[model samples]
Target chain A: MAGGGAAASALSTPWRSLLQRALDGNAHLKHSTFFQLATVGGGGRPANRTVVFRGFQEQSDKIQINTDARSNKIGEIRNCSFGEICWYFTDTWEQFRISGFIDVVDGSNPEPVKLQLRERAWFGSSVKSRLQYLGPCPGLPIPDDDLIKDAHLDPSAGPVDAFCLLVLDPEKFSYRNANAIPWMLSWPSILVCYVNVKAGGAGLLEINYGQAMNAAFKRWLVEVNRKTGPPPQVANGRLHIA
Target chain B: MAGGGAAASALSTPWRSLLQRALDGNAHLKHSTFFQLATVGGGGRPANRTVVFRGFQEQSDKIQINTDARSNKIGEIRNCSFGEICWYFTDTWEQFRISGFIDVVDGSNPEPVKLQLRERAWFGSSVKSRLQYLGPCPGLPIPDDDLIKDAHLDPSAGPVDAFCLLVLDPEKFSYRNANAIPWMLSWPSILVCYVNVKAGGAGLLEINYGQAMNAAFKRWLVEVNRKTGPPPQVANGRLHIA
Candidate 1:
């Protein structure tokens, strides 16, 4: 297991732990988080849309979002194979900007890992959500409100073909205070990390402190694994919590 | 002015008018409005950030957003020359996805029109907003909370060199019902339009209706001016209301 995000001498509680706790769960996580999925479209013009955050896997160093297979974003993801998701839990006064190259899992990739992920994602889906793909392509014209409301599918038949898991393998994480002062003033956050994608490899970490916007912390290629407490050492095979 | 987007027969009220009313002044515009500024970085990865809706120009088919000169977004816009802004005002239950190319005006462009727009934007900016540029480059590390809180400029000195006007020249508009149901179902909104950049020129318009997601309204090269009203025809030059 790669292990490098050490606690800085400045703050009593490490910022990584603060982030981990936020990701672990809270009361207001659902409302505040927005997934930023930007794709390079024609003429290299980027198309960005906000989607609901389905899940985040700290162990795999991946963030998860769901999308309809028929949606424009799926095409964009396939074309670019990279994107970013910005999450702000204003309740916690913290924001995270994650840039990751995407690794998708859908009905096509029927491996055990994919199956486990899809099954887990399916368990979380509501009948209303499962029916999102039953209608025509998104960003297209619809007949009327009544027609749109009536465009539901039979749930007994199980999830449709459009259900997809977009797991973002994060390479960089930018943590910042979501207040009017420091954030607006461009004062850097206390912590930032650049994770190397290589399995069991080290990552770059930077921490800042002191009074006058000083450069207090910067580290290169620290050993980093999935978690802080006793690395699970899942290097041999991938496993997840059900 | 090209006037092809005549009020459609399907809906009792046209979608354009509905949108115009919402933008005219409503309690709900602030939360849902986010400008989608996409710029292709050196690696071709597009950078996207949400900016406040400074204002919207119905007469000249332009939308307004303010940004700092030192911010990364301004650099991206100058590189791309075009971007998109997605606005979802849930209170009115209307979502607008506007596609526009870019035209920026700062103190550098001292034309009367530019000066007027800049002055109007300046009036809307708060002291806190004006102070955003005094800090270091955004997305950079900061030393501490005190450093951030102390990083404000003297109010009497006024706005800094970082303040710039971002006027988006709109080419397309997609307005949809903001209810989670149909919008998630990818059902198209009631009104969509394509505005030609040329003044007093015809633009394409498309409206949808019927029971089965039908395309009932389509107008090619219809006269399209800023307002969907009887043409005052400002074809010779770009004119806007104060």
Candidate 2:
């Protein structure tokens, strides 16, 4: 029965594909509130913050987001490209967590592709101001503080040294969905994509039964289990995000 | 002038003593809405999650909180008795991120400590119940589903196993405060207690400047930076959660 169920799910990829399409069509991503981004650095420790999804391209697995070049994250990502990105859809009780390496793209390059990105940036800024304020300057009137000027000033020009473009290429992806069974259980079952970064980007995807998903959901779980040559640990409880 | 600033912030025995008092004081610890608890399995990676502080004991460095026994965190600590605990205070932009191992005290044991903790739990539950849910539990039922009754019931038995008790014993600690000056420069500093977990739990507390504090703060900054990583690479920037 389990095998048949698995096969049925596999064959129903068109439905899943359509669902994915609908999710991508979601207007929330354009509003910069749909995704959470985390970066790991300073000797491989992980740190996370939220970011907006600026844009996505299907043909090339690359994402584009902007940041201050002077922000500590630029240094962290330069040191270690591996980081985790999470997208939570509350309406659907669904979360997608992706881990990948990032590369900073140069926005000023005059190449055709780069030009296209620059044009998109102009449109992006027009739609929503992408400037960040560095807190109000003291002594100066709050209105007098040139926050936007400081944020968008060219890094090479010495005032806004933090402005830069960030590009991320995900290697691993995991999807979790909350399942509600009448009078039985209300918890999420997860489907994980374990990308073998060193293996030419081949992914091992697994659908987890709720109880057995905890350790498997963790990044270190697979490594530790393999090294120790033991069956994975499984526990029951809902996972909470802080 | 620099030496004067360093000297002012230096940890004299009296200053250390005062900081310790603040840590122990119920009013100081309970002032914060959230506190971070970090735990590690023996030879395993560290895990951190925020938990509401129930209270603290000045004499024993004992802290109390509620947790589900089924949590993977409980299992992690079950194997490894030592861990770190950190409490953050954002109002003053001051934080005390402490490091310590935990000892799970037996609640059923007839120790005076157990009685005190039970009383606190009773009081805490009363307060927690009144607070509206912290975050939207999307897809949560308006009326929670009750557990199905067992065919055979014991009259004398109480409520089925639900909540569990957790007690933390802190060992090492770090204190951080944000300092901003006029113009465009600001630096956040930290005093970290590098606990010696290996050699009988004795170690030096070092004051790391510039890079170290930035690194510590980077953990909190990652989420913000992610808001800025590249745009989503997936087509339509969405993941189908199933």
Candidate 3:
């Protein structure tokens, strides 16, 4: 584990716990690991594709995703780092929409911890998966003889130049207030934090329970907010149910 | 069916057959109907979510997708009509990336044919699915009592104000040349065409089969292009395998 994501680690744990709960609940389904990732493409149009979630980076809230350096997404991220991940847990009937800036950690990155993370990601991948990167550039036409080149590949070698790791540092999490509150109400939810890591990780935890709730529920939200500590920061969009 | 999309009906049939084959092959899986739609949001950032495909509009290539008028996606589409759909067929191991401009047809749309399409989409939806629009505004805080309002709703009524039908008029279809060519090889593939409907349906069908494929494949592409009976117009990016 690297400390590069220490700033993002300050994000409140309740949302992480909710996500973990969903992951645990849907552990039986292999499809649970896949999520849709959206990126701003050329001409500022939107491009989206399904991607496998590797996991959270180290212990931070930042999401880790593996992509080929030669892929269109790599170019898309280079042009614009803004991205969003929409993950739906079928068993829990919960959808997490995380919008953030992605930090591309490739061979060009200077940070030692990031390089280590990249190495770890490389070593963690199966040999079959790693060999795909050694083939011709993705999305391009394949050469006449690709099979002959595979025999010379070394499985134990470090990640090739094409292996790139994307760390999405979440800036905001929006909850469809109605859908989120029902699940959190069971936990007597109060805290609604918007972790703005882009602000140098000064976590802005806002406890906003709208006036729509009943008097008793409002009182509980206030009571829980007082007990949670740290004053509310600048307001952002949407209620992030904890 | 309404004939508003008659102009786009000029798209060649081979590509349609390929997509049809994938759909027919994966008809057993319910998840096969769901695809990822990406739209350019505010600040030109990409926003993506899983959307159910309602199939092509009548006999044309235009994709029909039902959405709520109150949804952020509706607003995003209004801001910039450029959108892209990436659909992966698990059974066939095929991915289709179609980029186009979306036409939003709500109560405000004056076109009679478009209105008929909307009505058809509304009537096609399940009663339970249609009832959701009758509820509180989505993404907003729900009031204390919502269940009481559901009993008085008329399920058979015409589409509510929130219900909207989106017609994506595809301009370009991209293929990961390597992945697409292998599958299309079985069909003795030829003719990669880009249909540009944005030119008021002048239908710029560009036959651009790249030189990356072998000589036999190149000859096949030329023969197919000649048989298709139209001159290639306007160069575009990425191969569109047929």
Candidate 4:
């Protein structure tokens, strides 16, 4: 019911809550829910495509997405399972860049676990969605970058082999809130500067999915929220530091 | 001006024309001109972020871009130079996916060519854009993703070491037009598939920068257009094959 938290939980609580809303997809219409996905292509280059938001898995570790099976992105995923997705909600300038190892869940997989995933994915594939797969494979020399023919398969029959549900198993996350950035690791924060400098030399520090610090961040958030209600500023997506 | 034309003159003219529009950044509003850029991260996962549509350079293979030198993306570019960009116009459903080797030009470079490029990039940057570079480097976990302290640098005083100009040296392109897909590589077009299939199997087919086939494609588009004006259904974003 509350939005943000007290001094100590300032960072973690609001951050988690916002992401949860983004994952939910339908709850809010104020900001864009679409996310841009990035994957390494066969030529070892990074390739990107736009995908609408799908619900996050129960544990919040894996994300689900649907795409045309014949798209070039599928081919890139085939080469490397690693991926990153960037979500930018222009309304509040709130952006989340999540990186993960990706897996394609399609009907072809025979494993029981994979089959279960495929079944769930298949349920989302409407007759219209399935038609995209049956048409000409994308990336072909079509006049425009879309399937030439719209194959309307009977909904009762269900999706064909080309219907693909992509799952992103998150490994890292970069959260940026441009609107309410108050805490700065300035010259006074020598320790932070040292850490940032070290990370800088290595290029960038990736937030590992299972880091002890992340657990600390969650624990800290829970402890702070146990007593205090969400702060006022969070309603507008502001992140106030202690 | 005719839209597309001649296999003999095909590759260069049409290829040049399409890119000129993509590069123009201001000419047409018929479709969404925004492009999504994907770059491989130091951690081996793909990361995508947005950059505004800046004008393209004429008679040059390299496409121009300006970014904060402190941003994680600039650092990512330092590590791996490969990338892919996807553009979609909501109105026409016209999209282009271009892949290329990436490069960044900054104050750090002493080479004549790079320095020249940086100087040109500096002239185009507005004062507001330059301030982003002087502030905290992006991705630093300081309660927000952007710099908390907005450090405004004097425009007359010139840029800090953080202003960077990036260029993408495109190596491949995937053009898809859902509006008028007259050429379907259907079962009948198996021979055409054989050629494209061969190209596909080898993985991403990087355009040789100046390819004869690409030139021919543009020419073929022109030839097709002379007989056919904007097909009736292109406005609704429909894919129809003849």
lDDT of 3 by residue, A127-205 (tens): 6667666655442222223433452557678888888999998765643211322211222344353332232323322
Per-residue lDDT over A30-122 for candidate 1, one digit per residue giving the tens place of the 0 to 100 score: 444444466666677766666666655434455667776766677777778877555544344445556668877777885987767875776
lDDT of 2 by residue, A1-242 (tens): 11122222333232233224325434353321334455543444434443545554334445566665555567777776655565544344344555566775445545766545644544454312333423222111111223223434343221122335677775555443432211111234543322221222221222333334443124333433344342111225322111
- Using TM-score as the measure, which candidate wins? 3
In order of DockQ, best first, we have 4, 3, 1, 2
Each candidate's interface RMSD (Å, one decimal) is: 6.3, 11.3, 6.0, 6.2
**Tens-digit lDDT track for model 4 on B36-119?**
788887767687876654445434545667776767687788788877887654433345667787788778887987877777
On residues B71-188, what C-alpha lDDT tens digit does candidate 2 reach at each position? 5566777776655454433333334544445655434446876656654454455432312122122111112212211423343332222244577654444443322111111223
Off by over 4 Å in 2: A1-34, A60-64, A88-94, A106-123, A126-130, A133-161, A170-179, A182-242, B1-242
Candidates' C-alpha lDDT: 0.49, 0.40, 0.61, 0.52
Q: Which segments of model 1 are wrong by more than 4 Å?
A: A1-30, A88-94, A110-112, A138-158, A178-180, A183-242, B1-17, B20-36, B90-94, B110-112, B137-159, B178-242
Higher-ranked by DockQ: 1 or 3: 3
Judged by DockQ cut-offs, the docking class of candidate 3 is acceptable
Report how closely model 4 matches the true complex, as a DockQ value.
Answer: 0.32
By the lDDT metric, which is better: model 3 or model 4? Answer: 3
TM-score: model 1 vs. ground truth = 0.61
lDDT for each residue of candidate 3 in B1-242, tens digit (9 for 90 to 100): 22123423544554454455556657777667777788988787778776778878876788888888878799999998888887766545556677789999997899999988999899987765676566454322222233324525576678888789999987766543113222212223444533322222222132223223444444533444444433333324333433
Q: For each candidate, what's the DockQ?
A: 0.20, 0.05, 0.30, 0.32
Q: Pick the candidate with the highest DockQ.
A: 4
